[model samples]
Target: MQAFIGASLLSSSAAQPKRKPFEIYDRRLQGFTLRVQSTGVRSYYARFGRNRRVVLGKVGTLAPEEARERCQKVLGHFAHGRHPLHGIGGTDAITLGMFIADTYTTWVKASRPRTAANTLEKLHRLFRTWYPEPLTAITLERIESWKARRLNAGRSAATVLRDLFTLSSVLRRAVTVGELTENPVRRVDKPRIDRRGKVRFLDQAEESRLRDALKARDEEMQKLRTAANERRQKRHKELLPRLTHFGDHLTPALLLSMNTGLRRGEVLKLRWACVDFDRRLLTVEGRNAKNRQTRHVPLNEEAMSALQRWREQSGSRRRLFDVATGFRTAWEKLLKRATITRFRWHDLRHHFASRLVQHGVPLNTVRDLLGHSSVAMSLRYAHLAPDQRREAVAKLNEKPLLALTMRLQWDGFPAGSHYRIDSMVEREGLEPSTPAL
Candidate 1:
């Protein structure tokens, strides 16, 4: 049908078809169209080329005149041999929130299941204001201004850098999928950070206190379990198992991490099949590993003992630990009981690496044991192994054989007496050569 698409025609139900959908072509513009669905839903559209069509927006959301202006812009682009939706993936009207909700979220969830929730939440919280804005509207200047604000608000440079990185990743994905021509974040200067900052680990005194706390906790839990079982027996109920060996998974879990340097995720996701008692090795599956590569960590006596005790206690469960949620609450409680300050669960891994380095383990070996991708990461612990440097410097203090012989020849001379070189040479049972002069 050919007619002028006006506001009154759009608002009136007379133009809406009850049986089938229909399009009303604009009399003013050649390819402008208004599509009215059978259910009476109406939207504006622009038709270009042979069979191309672009839905501008719903009739109520965009007025006929406003849709007409947008349609003209799209048609003008098409006439100039340019893609009507060039920068955007398919539609010029896609906003940041729309793109994230409709596209990026699905891709990220599939590719990065472990961090998808946190990453998506951070994106939503940090860029909520930008949700209504189009992707192209996120310019370098705007990002720079945001970064400045965050810094001025007492956020650390490292944190601001991380935020920028996350934002840039989203924009980079847009560019990769043709939703954007370029990533403006590429032009923004990232905040500087010192990568080699001091690493936190437990000292001897703190480690001792932590061990004492663990032992105390286990004893207390065992007493409670005994009391509970006794009460159950008195009530004629099924007797729960007694607490033997370690109190719970927490003690063994901490020991394993401290010995093997496994990440918290890897430790939580560990399975009985991955542990090899005979080979004294624990395998981090590729799926659980951050780098997506399987790595075998050699289990020392402590790690092996922890795993063995845990297996005996946990029974035939497929996974080693039954912790569905993280250990944040339990960990904080344990740290408080131990009276250890400025330490984190991740510091257990650092403690393992630091101990190995202090014991004169090679940096390359430390890198492999820690599952670091490169030796450079393990270099942070290099200061712990100063014995080789000390030995090298100690060599400078040893007297040479020639110097020892020269000193012995002058040993009998009086204090502060000057000895001739020729006399000294002769005294040392050697021929004195004549000087050229």
Candidate 2:
């Protein structure tokens, strides 16, 4: 309730309290005050913008001088039209863990569940060290050092970059909610990723091998399931059902991925409602799509036939495949059984795009089918378009000449060729500057 010239009087001033709570303003620093509670507790706060005030810290944790300095920062932010609690939060006590749990993850789960899950996993694994630290304690230098440590620890640039981006996004959200004045991640340079333009897709031989392998796998599964069912019924008389559910999913899932160019998440999350048998269209809803954009992809004969067979077998099942449990293990086994090497599930998308480009589908159409946000993403497949570069080169000479001037010299052509040359030159309205012999 009174002004003080120096911080030396703060302890004495806080030792005594009135019947109700009151604030003692700093004579040295405007907007800085120490709040004295009726219980004889005191804390520093910065008052700004009418009735708005943000806590700096308790008296014991921050000296009066330190509190005044922090208040000056709040005043500076308020001058720039930013909230005083931008970096410190409402109470200056919220930690990185609390901010992520209470705010960042909630928004991410609503807007992009896949990203939320992935980022949460990576952050927990890579950044648990910072969980207990206050949000304001994280700095640009610390982020750069963390990136360097990750790179030195044999983490890929792409993976580290993804983790860094997730951290950056969380901090940026903090900024939006006035929990951070600035994002430290923005000041640090992202790791340089060397992504060459290599489009990995199945060629004819690889495709044949893959199909044969899949057929073999299906047949092998059928044999095993039949044997299991026979033994369960006749020999064991067991109460449990057959274990054949696992094998049935892999073939159909791979088939759908290869034919439709669907990402793994999209394929796993596919439902019956999104597929229209009548229209031969598979619709990826905005919520389920990677870019949050809806896209309708046409089903070719192969995809259509596969879907029809799957629908009959699914028999009112909400999901087309029981792949919700996940396919990583089965996928690895299938690849190993088929002797396929160095191919991930995403390569199937590339296979689809490659086939389309080789068959002369336009890049923009591919972009739409793939649900890419921009044509630049689809441009990687432009090289695969059949005869595109060749056609461009062919345009160099609209009408190519085929005649040969054999036995000719600097002089005019021989008697019979003279008419041809003269008429051609006259027609073109050009000069014949052949030196006379």
In terms of lDDT, the poorest run of 10 residues in model 2 is 399-408
Instruction: Estimate candidate 1's alpha-carbon lDDT, on a 0 to 1 scale.
Output: 0.83
Model 2 alpha-carbon drift over 4 Å, by segment: 1-94, 194-196, 231-247, 393-437
The sequence of per-residue lDDT tens digits that candidate 2 reaches over residues 217-272 is: 77787678778778788876763433333247777778888888999889888889
C-alpha root-mean-square deviation, each candidate: 7.7, 8.7
For model 2, what is the alpha-carbon lDDT of residue 407? Answer: 31
TM-score, structure 2 vs. true: 0.68
By summed lDDT, the worst window of 10 consecutive residues in model 1 runs over: 413-422
lDDT of 2: 0.78
Best by TM-score, which number?
A: 1
